[model samples]
Every structure is written in structure tokens, then in C-alpha cells.
Target: MHFDLPDLRLFIHIAESPSLTQGARKAFLSPAAASARIKALESQLGSRLLYRDSRGVELTPAGQRLLQHARLIMRQVDYLKSEFTEYGTDAAGHIRIFANTTAVTEFLPEVLAGFLAERPGVTVDLQERLSRDIVRGVLDGAADLGIIAGPVQAPGLQVLHFSTDRLVLAVPLGHALAQRQSVSFNDTLAYQHIGLHEGSTLLSFLREQVEKLGGNLALRIQVSSFEAICRMIEGGVGIGIIPESAARRHSRTMQLAILQLDEAWAVRERSMLVRELDALPGSVRALIDRLKQGV
Candidate 1:
């Protein structure tokens, strides 16, 4: 059915929120205005698109089918706008990127610096989020790209590996394990451990690895940020296992020590994740190409 872009966007927003009022708020339109748009769309398509009840609005069969096509059309429209605006310039446009805290703090500076040097007009907006949230942002079109820890399983996205990082054990300089060249997972369980908060990918990965080894991690404190975890470990709250790059940086600033985990217990992977590989804008594509070349 022929539909204007604004009405389709309103419909998709309604489909996602399922509350006319909530959708209107998100779309920054009055409820009446939003409802009118939906009605106009329904009339043009000659079908009832929504059913309202005490439980809020539910999409009809036609609405469900149209929702899929609507999303695709909206994405293409956005891409087309970005493409036209970005043409004939040195990657001049906005690039919204979502990366995990560790990447934001430790890994992305060099890459971002280099990217900006090459494409001075391109504005880069980067935010730190959890790995899962990073993936969601990219898939939902809220972010142009994301860099996070690997092995994320999500459909309709392409994953690429650019670098490998290992989880290292960090402790106070005076901790008994500080001098050890390497320690095992069981060795870590002996001490009180500082860890990332529950929903974190690092925490979940460590938990799974420990569980697979028929053991459980004994956490003394669960902090929300890597920087906080490092600060706590440095203050002697407890030892922590964090990405090697993060640990190394903290080591330079504080009296912290790091030891590589035993090979079997070490969780290491090329820092990788999924994104729309083919749909990336020129600026994003340039950055991805550099990453692929290990630049």
C-alpha cells in the first residue's frame, strides 16, 4: 500500500510500543495526531491495522505483515538520507558508535584518533554500554557500529574479528598471587574476588567458565564499571579478572599486579562483534577496513 514515510514511522513506533499514548510520546506527536496518522494509513491501505482493548493496542494480521516491510523501508530511507548527505566529502557525516566500557576507555582512543585524522569532517559519537546493549543498538539502527567482546550470537548481522584479548587476573601488589607467572581458575576462587555486575558479559563469561570447570566463583563485591572494579582491587578489596588491556593500564597508575591465567582457564578472544557489514556508510566502512588491516 502507498504510505508516506511519516505515517509509516508512526505505525512502526505504535507497533513497537503497543500503546497509542506511549507511541505518540515517542514520536513527539499528540495522541490525537498519532491516531489520526494511523487512521489515515489504515484508510489508504483499506484495512484495519490495529485493535484496541484494555490491554492496549494489538496489531491486526495486516499490521504485522506491514510492520516488517515498514521497518525495511524506514531503514532504506535513513540510509539514503545518510548516503546523499555524506557524498563527495572525506567521510563527512555523523557516525554513532556503541562500545563496551573497556573498549571506550582503553581500546578505541587510537582507532578514533586515526579515524578522525583521516576523515576530519566526520563527527563520531561514541557511547559506552554493555555488550548486549551494544549489539541491540546496532541492530535497532540507534548506532552505526559497535565494537565489543566476541562470540555474540545475533541474527541478521555480520561479525568480524580484529584483535584478541585475554582476561587477566589483577590483584594488589602485595597479594600472594602477585608474583605468580600464571594462575588457574581454581587459584582465583581461593581469594575474595571483585567482579563486574551481574549482567555484564565478562562476569557471565567468567561464571560459565568456572562452572564448566566444576567450581563457583566467590565474589566479594560486584561493581558496575571496570574502572571501579580496578579501583577496588587496587584498594585491596579483592583480586579481579579483567581484560588484559584494562589491567595493564590500571597497573601503571596503581600498585596493582596482573598475572596471566592458566591457558585452560584463560578466556581469550579476538575483540569482535556483529554489524550490518554491507550497509555501513562510507565513513564507517573506512574505519572497518582499517580495523581489518590491523591499522
Candidate 2:
């Protein structure tokens, strides 16, 4: 019950090599020392663990069973070393995280909260920027990580799919578009839109959609957040297109209707972007893993 790791490791080494002399050499012990150690281990276990002959050493049944458990124990020890190694660093680190409005509003707050909770030693500098700007921030080394909507053009950037979201039109309960289930992006253009600020990703995307469809995106007002846009819709100010996740949250608190859009470009894929994988520090790599897990 109190046997040392060296005994278990030597048992595995001898079992693998089938030669006490060769296994002892591999374990950095003399043959005489290896033989004495095995005898002591066998005496402690109350069972013979090896068959030694001119051919070399072979494991008895007990040695095979010990080998199985020893492998499991070694794996757990390795995991403990890997998992606990990061906690040894006392220096505080900051990760510059840049994300678009949709991800910042709809998804990442919860993810970041959990990541920060588990990693108290690290600080996150979260910034809201457009997807293009997020890419620029990473490329310019201004940000360590980026979460942005795709159809992105970052030739040298490493990216992974983070989440999928769609832009939907939200309207008041008795509004003209409420009775219908879906509407084309162009068809909704006639109605005034309550949107985010002019430079927001959603606003820029809407403007792009309007130009591609040859329609007028009649924007009558602009707000800072999706909740504000939904509140404007609830007050009968005007209907607006917002992320489905943000729309769902506001719908619970306000009398708003979610209308799915009839356009193919409505679904937006969000991705995590980095300059290079190996360039990141171990702690930063762990942060990326946590983000990938949505932790």
C-alpha cells in the first residue's frame, strides 16, 4: 500500500522490455539494484511478479495486472501535472478580446464570466468592434483574440467557428409584420428601421443587404444596443432586424414578435480569430481552449 513510484515504474519497464538488465539500464539503474528492487517489491506485494531465465524476464499474471493499474496511475499523474502547472505562475496576464456587437450582446458575456471565474489570475480586456476591425486588431497585434461574424477575409489568420446567429425582424405584437411568419429583406425596407449606430456591424450589414437587393433601408433612428432596438419596436417606434439571440431575450421582457427573414444572407456565422496558434503563451492557449468550450 505504501510502495514508491520507482517500484511501479520499474515493474512496467521490466514488463515492457522482458529483460531485467535492459529495463534497469533504461530506468537508469544498475542490474544489481534493479534485481534487489524487484525482490523487495514482490516481497511487499506477497506475490511473485516475474519469471527470470536465460531468455530474459517475463511477467507473471500479477505483474500484468499491476502493469494495467500502473498505466492508469501514470496517466492520472500526467494529467495532474499538466492541469496544475498553469496555477504555478504568479504573474497576472491580460487577454485582449475583441468582438462584434452581436457576439458581445448575445453570447460572450456568459462565456467570459465563466472563463474569468475559473481563471482569477487573468484579466480580460473585452472591446466591442466590427468584425473587420476585430481582424485588424489581431493582425496589428492590438488584440490577443477575436470573435467576429464571417464572410471574413483574413488571409493569414487562424479561425474557428464559435457560434451561428441570424438577423431577424422584431416588431410590436399588433404591428403590420407581426401576423406574418417571414418577410424578404427588401420587402421590409419600406418600413422604417430602428437600428444600432451607423458604424455597427448589424447596421453595415443591413446597408450592404439593401445595396445588393436594390432596396431602400429606411433607417429612421439609431440606438446603441439590441435591447434598445427591441424596446423601440415594443413602443411602436419602428420594426428592426436584430440577432435572433438578442431578440429572444428582449421578447421575454417586452411585447415583441420575432419574424424570420426570407433572405439567404440572414444567417451569420461567428468565428474566433487568432494570428497564429503556437505564437500564444500557454496561459493564453488555455484561455482559447476555454473559449472554444464556451466555458
Candidate 3:
């Protein structure tokens, strides 16, 4: 059966939100208009796509099948728009990028600025998420690229090494470890530490390193973002170990002192993730090339 792009989009939105009003808001249409469109789509396809109840909307069996294809179709439509718009335009299109907090606050601003300077027409949309979620975004074709610390071991992803960033200890200016040139893993264990919330890759890496040194890192504050952790550090909540790049960004604003970790505990590597090596768009390729060339 033939289906228009708008119908496909509305279907996907309805399936995602499962609320007629919510889907209508997303589609910028009134609830009545959205419902009419959905009913029209169902008529054309000869199936009931959704069932309404007191709780919310639920998808029918056929709706479930159509939802997957609808997402793929929408993604291809987006890719087509980006691809055609970027051609012969010196990067005049949307590039959706996903990154972790560290990359968002520390690394991406400069890279995006340089890219936009060279190609002023390009628009970049950046979303901050955990590293694993960033990878998932790329893999699912929701984001064109990802900037994260690795090692990420997804099967179908093309990983490119961007730069190495060490993990450093950030202490309040007057803290005892502030004067230390390098802190041992065991030394960090002696203090109450500020850590990223559970499921964070950086937190896991730090925990593993400390455990290896037979150090029980006591986590005092569990924050979800790097900025929050920095503020906590600034408030003298506890010392934090964060990416050197991120620590550098906050050093000017907060009365924080950065100390290097012993080489054994130093975490490094900022990797760029893409869906496939051969599938990169020209705009993405240009950005990656710039990163590799350090231009």
C-alpha cells in the first residue's frame, strides 16, 4: 500500500507517545486533526493502528510492525534531506551529534565553533547523554556522530581516535591533595570522592582502577553531569576525578586545583563514533578529517 511521508510521521509519533494529544502537539496539529490523519492512514492501510483506553493509546499488532518501518522511512527521509542540502553548499545542513557531558562542556564547543567558522551555513544540534547512550544514538541512526571516551565495543560502529584526555583529580584550592603533583590511587581512596551516578562509563572506569589498587573509593555525592560535579567540588563537597579536558574548563571559574593521577590510574582517549566507515556523509567526513588533521 502507498503511504505519504506525513502519514508515516504521524503514525510514528502516535506510537511513540501513545497519547493522541501528545502526538498532536508533536505534529503541531490539533487533536482532532491528528486523529483524522491517523484514521485516514488506517483506512488506506486497511488496519486498525491504535486502540484507545482510559490509561493511554496502545498499538495494535499491525501498528507494531508498521512502527519499525516508519522509523526507518523517517530516518531515510532525514538522511536524504541532509545529503541533498549539503551537496555543493559547503556544509549547509543539519548534523545531529550526541556526546557525553565531558565532551559537550569541554571538547565539542571548540570543534563545533571551528567547523561553523569554516562552513557558516551548517547547523549542529548536540545532545548530552551518557557515553553508552551516545553510542546507541549513533547505532540507531538517530544521531550522525558521537563524541565519547572509550573503549566502546559496539560491533557495527566505526571508531576513530580523536585525542587522548587524562582523568585528573580536582580538589578544592585549600584541600590537602591540592599541592600534590601526582596522586596515587590509594591516596584518592582515603578521601570522600564525588562520583558520577550509576551506569556512567567514567564512574565504572574509575571504580575499576581504584579497586585494582585495593582502594575503596568512598563516593560522597552521586551527580549525573560533569557541571554538577564541578559545582560540588567547588562547594568543597568532596574531591572529584574527571576528564582533564573537563577539569580545565572549570578551573577558571571554580577555586579548584587539578592533580594528575599515577600513570596506572590515568584514563585517556576521546573517540569519535560513526555508524560505518563507508556510510559517513561528506559533512561528517569533513569534520572527521579536520579532527584528525587538528585543523
Candidate 4:
């Protein structure tokens, strides 16, 4: 089907946004115009693209396929614009990166800062997601690259070693589990917990692990940041599971204890994933290479 760049841009925005109106707003189109453009695109392709419902919009199988290519096409267009317009200028391209919370919170900041400083002509669009979702987004071409942690499987994508961070239980200094050197997740579930909010990947992973073992946590408090959770743990509120990178730094300043988990999953190796290494623009590729420095 012959659709213009605006049509494809609108389609990609609609597919990624929570609602059509929101997508239209992002695309700088009115709702009516967006709807008409979508209809025109679908008619050209001879298939439905999106399924609309009360909750929001979901991509039809065809829509999903279109979205995958749309992202790649947009990236190419962006690259072309950057290269042509800024031939002699410093900044040139955009890099879209999707990373898990662990990577974002613990490691990516320093690495990304270094890359951005070295490559001033490049801009970055970074979003946080769960490890599995990061892998899915990369494979689907929704993002140029992804950094994920935990034992996630990405069948067809290229995965490179990124970094490692241990997950541990943070307990009050005088709490029962505090003095223990290493404890299993199951062994700690019976105690009250201070966890990240429900939608966090870490929280979901912990709950799934507990349920599989026929145990559950009594989450007494939920907080938005690791610092808040650590504070609650130090106040004898409840135990919390947090990345060792964050917990260790806070441990020296707070009356909190870090207990390692006996489970193998506790020590996780993070990976940086890409759909195709060679297809990336030069600036984006440079950033990726810099991120792989220590690996």
C-alpha cells in the first residue's frame, strides 16, 4: 500500500499510545483526521489495523506487523534528516532505547551520560520497561535497542553482556532476618514486606516466585523509590527486596541490613539486546559500543 510518511507516523503513534485521542494529540492531528487517516491506510492495505475497545486500542495482527516496519522506517527517515540537515553540524541522529528498571536505576545513567557527552550531536529517547517487555519491544522493532536483566529469553535478537546486579532483601538492623547471611525468597515471605508498587517488574517477579512456592508476601507498604523502601525497612516497618547496587550504598548510612538470597536468580546478568547490529545509524551504534565497554 502507498501511504505517506504522515499516515505511517500516525499509525505508529496510535499503535504505541494508550488511546487514539492521545496518539492523535502526540501526532499533532485532530481525532477526526487521525481516524480518517487510519481508515485510509487500512483500505489501502485491505486489512484492519487496530481494534478499539473501552480499555484502549490494541494492534490487530496486521497492525502489529505494520507497526514493526513503521518504527524502522521512521528511524531511517530520522537518520536521513539528521545526516542531510546537519552535514557539518555536531548533533546528527536519535537513539531510541528501552531498558528495564534495574538497568535504568543502577547502571544506565553513568553509561548514557558518558555517551551523550562524547556524542553531542545525538539525542536519546529512553523508556523504562520490564526485562521481558524490553526484549519484546526490541524484537518488534519498537525500540532501536534494549537493556534487560534477569534470566529472560530473547530468541531471535542479538544479546550482549551489559552488567550484573544482585537482588537482596533489606531488613531492619534488629529484625529477625538481619543477622542471616543468606536467605531464600520463600524463607522471607512470611514476614511483612515493603515493596515497590504493584506494576513494577521486580514486584511481579517476586510475587510469581512466591506463588509458585505456595507462599505469599504480606506487603505492608508500597513506595515509589528504592530510597523510600529502604527508609521504611530501617524503621522496622517491614523487609524489602531491592537491587544490591542501591541497597549497599544506603546500608552504610542507614540502620538497615542487606541479606543475600540463596536462590541462583538473585545474581542476575543484564544484557543489551538489538534486532540487527548493522542496521543502526552511526551515532546510535557508537552509543551501543560505549555501553558495551566493560563487557
Candidate 5:
């Protein structure tokens, strides 16, 4: 069967979006045109590629295989364009990363600052997402790399150790929980708690865990950053659960107490994820290497 790059690209867009109309819009084609092209592609390949429903479309088994190949082909095509373009100037590339709250807020800023300083020709697009979503984005080619926390079961992705993260309760110097060495997260739910802003991955994870325990987090206030959360706790507004790294950094000036969590999930191993480390472009691989070195 014969198909063109546009056909492959259109299919990739459709699979990523799982919405025919949205995919057509991304490809700069009308819905009717996109549907016709998809029909033609199915006829040529002699396979039913998508299962359509009222909500959206889902890829069939053959479609999943085609998607894997399509992503690889597009990545190679992009690499070729970048390589040829660099003949007239310094090497240039872009990498996309999806990471969780701790990696995005506590870790990546310093690491990326140094990485970008040395490579003026390179750029990065970073987004904060839940660990599960981060894995899916990397696997589906939406992101070039991912940083995830806790345990992950990824079948086809390469995992690299990044760092360890611990979630702890931060309280004012004389708070009742502050006198204790450690406590279950459930024990803190009765007290008012400061929290990160809505939609933060940490806040979302905390909510999920609390729900599992058949309780709710009594959030007293919402703030934008971990530093702000520490400040709020220092002022005796409420206690908050924050990454241990942030707690240590802010504790130097803020009379805050860091108490370890008893739950196993509170201690997490952060890891770097990539679909195929060897297949990545040189510039992308270099950044990963730098991150591994703690630079």
C-alpha cells in the first residue's frame, strides 16, 4: 500500500487527539476532507483503524502499530530538518518534558537553568502533570521526555534514576504534630491544612489519597508555591504537606518543623523516562545526560 507524509501525519494527529474534527483542524483540513482521506488510507491498508463513538474515536490494534511507526518516522524527519538547518548556524533543537509537581517546582529549575545557559541554541518546553499522565504523554510521543515520582510500570519506556522525594508535614514550631517524629497523613486531616493552588499535581494526589482513606483534607488556605505554603504555616495559619527538599530550604529562616509521613507512598523515587534513549536526537540526549550528572 502507498501513502504520503500528510496521510501519516493526519493519522498521528487523529490518534493523539482521539477526535476527528480536532485532528482535522490541527492538520489544516476540513472534517469532510480528513474523513475522506482516512477512508482512503483504510482502503489502502485493508484494516479498520479506528473505532468511532459519540464521545471520540479509539485506535484499533493495527492503528496502534501504525501510530508507533508514525511517531518514529516523524521524529526522524524532524531530526533531518534540524541537522540540515544547523549547517548555516549553531546546532539547534527543542525538547519537550512532562514532569510532576516536585520535579517541576523543587528540582528542574536549577538543572534547566544551567543546561540552557551552556546551549543557547537549544530550547525546552516543560509542563507539570500527574505521573500517570506524564507516562502516557511520553509513550504517545506528545513529550520527548518525562520525570515521574513513585513507582511506575512502563512496558516500553526506559527509566533512569533522578532523585528521591519525600512528602512531609510542615508545621509551626510549637504545633502539636511538630513535637512528633512522624505521623500518618490521615492523622493530619483533622487540622486545617494549607495547600497548593487548585489543579496542582501534589494537591490532586493528596486529595486522591485522602478520598481513599474515607476522609477529606480540611484545606484552610491555598497558595501558589511551596515557599508560600511554608510562610503560611510559619504564621500559624495551618500545617501543609510539602516536599522535604522545600521544607529544608525554607526551614533555615522559617521556624517550621518537618515531620516525616508514615505512609509508604510519601517516600517516592523520582525517575526520568524516555521511549527510546538511543533513538533520541543528540541535543535531547545531551540534556538527559546533563540531568543525570546533577548539573
Candidate 6:
């Protein structure tokens, strides 16, 4: 039995996306065309691949097995293209990275800007995820690299120290808690909070902490970036938990107060994870080096 690369790619997209229509759009195929192709593939394999429903599609057991092999093949194909770039080929390189909220918002922008400027032929798809999810994404080959925080437990993946990330409480200058040097997370729960948008790793972590303490986070507003959260806090809309770097930087120009968190989880050691370091493409490796330099 022969499996076509395009068919496998389409299947991968379908498995990753929420719906067949969205997957078809990603693969640049009309819905009918995508369905026909999947039918043909299922016929060739003599097994059902996906479960269709009104909500979305779910992969069958057979589909999961196929997805494993498909991802491996696609990764190899990408590596092949990247390797050719070393031999005077103009094949563009693409790197996928999954990172935590702090790395995404505070650390990566400047570093990626410089890296992308220097390598016009290289492209990066950077996503923000929980640190645990970042590890899973890298280990599953969904991302070429992952930037994680706090304790790491990736058994076989190569890990490197990235940077230190600390969480802090930001309040308006005249707020009652502003005079405090530090405070427990639960202590701040009584006041309204400016939080990062939903799905942010930091927000998720804060929610988890609040749940553990049997308290609810009183989120006054949810903003897209740490800077926005700082702005909201400065305006006395609410106080917020944000990275120390962001709180410090914004405090210089905004009427905000930075208070250290008293919990052990507040201070995190960030690290980078890869399935294999030497196996990474040259461009991906170079970007890793740049990150290590804190540039």
C-alpha cells in the first residue's frame, strides 16, 4: 500500500484541527475534495480513520496510529528540506516553538525579531501554552522546541536552562496593598484583578492556585498582554499578577506598584526542551543559541 505525502499532510491537519472544514481550509482544499481524499485514503487502508459528528471530528484508533507515522514522516521531510539549505539550496526553513506566557510575552519578541531579521529565509511559528503542554508538544513532535518554566520532568528530551521568570503583584500606587513588600496570592484574591486573556499559562496557573486555596480569583478585566494588564492596574481598574520583568518595566512609566509574591511557585526557572539537540536543523539550533545568550 502506498500513502501519498499530501494525503498524509491533509490527514495530519484534520487530526489537529477542530473540524474537517477547518482542516480543509488549512490544506487549501475544498470541503468536498478533502472528504473524497479522506475516503480514498480510508479505502486504501481498509480502516475507518475519523468519527464525524455535529461538533467536530474525532480520530479513531486507526487514525491515531496513522497520525504517529505521519508526524514522523513530516518531521523528516522538513529536516531534509532544512538540510539542503546548508548546501547552497534556497529551501526556506521553518521552526515551531511552544513556550510559556512569560517567554512568549517578555523574552521571545526581541530575540525572535533579531533572529528573523538576520535569517530572511527562516520562519518561526511560536505559540504560547502551559509549561506542561509545551513539554508535551515538543515530545509529540508537534513543535520543534519548547520553552518551559518551573520544574521539568521530560525523561528523554534534551533540556537546557533558559532563564529565570518570577511572578509579582502589580497594584496602583495608592492602592491599599501597594505599601506591602510582598503578599500571598490568596491575600490578593479579595481585590479585583486584571488578568491575562483566557488560555494564558499564567492565568491558568493563577486559577489553579486560587482553586487550591478554595478561593475564586476576582478578575476585573482580561487583557491580551502583560503591558495591558499593567496599564489596567495603573488606572486602578484592578491589581494583577504578572511577570516581574513586565511589572518592573511598566512601573517606570506607569503609576504602578510592584510587590513580590510570597509563594514558592512565584519564582520559576525556565528551560528549553528539544527531542534531540544535534538532530535539530541549523536554523533551529542557531535560534536556540540566540535564546541562550538572552538576546
Predicted model with the maximum lDDT: 6
- Per-candidate TM vs. native? 0.77, 0.67, 0.76, 0.89, 0.81, 0.91
lDDT of 6 at 261: 94
Once fitted onto the true fold, the runs of candidate 6 whose alpha carbons sit more than 4 angstroms away are 18-33, 53-56, 86-92
lDDT of 1 by residue, 128-161 (tens): 7777787776676667777877567657677777
- In the range 151-244, model 2's lDDT, one tens digit per residue, is 8898879988856878888999998889999998877988999989867877887888788877788877999999889889999999999989
In model 1, what are the clashing residue pairs, if there are any? none
Model 4 agreement with the true structure over 80-194: per-residue lDDT tens digits: 6765655333345778889876666667788878777866777888887877778888887778888877776899998888678899999998888878998998888889999
What C-alpha lDDT does candidate 1 achieve relative to the native structure? 0.78
lDDT of each: 0.78, 0.79, 0.80, 0.83, 0.87, 0.88
Tens digits of per-residue lDDT for model 5 on 141-193?
A: 77889998888888889998867878999999999888899999989998999
List ranges where model 4 is wrong by over 4 Å. Answer: 18-21, 51-58, 80-91
Task: Name the runs in model 1 displaced over 4 angstroms.
Answer: 12-19, 39-71, 86-90, 113-143, 152-156, 263-267, 271-276, 293-295
Task: Return the lDDT, model 2, position 294.
Answer: 50
Candidate 6 Cα RMSD (Å) = 2.4
- Report clash pairs, candidate 3: none
| Clash count (model 2, backbone only) | 0
How many clashing residue pairs appear in each of the predictions shown?
A: 0, 0, 0, 2, 0, 0
In Å, residue 39's CA in model 2 sits off its true spot by: 75
Cα lDDT tens digits, model 6, 52-166, are 9999999999999898788878987998788887533322589999998888888799898978887788889999988788888887788999998787899879999967878
Instruction: Give the TM-score (vs. native) of candidate 3.
Output: 0.76
Q: Which of the two, 2 or 6, has more lDDT?
A: 6
lDDT of 3 by residue, 22-132 (tens): 988898889899999999988998999899887779999998878867866776676666667734434766678887666776667888888989887677888877777
lDDT order of candidates, top first: 6, 5, 4, 3, 2, 1
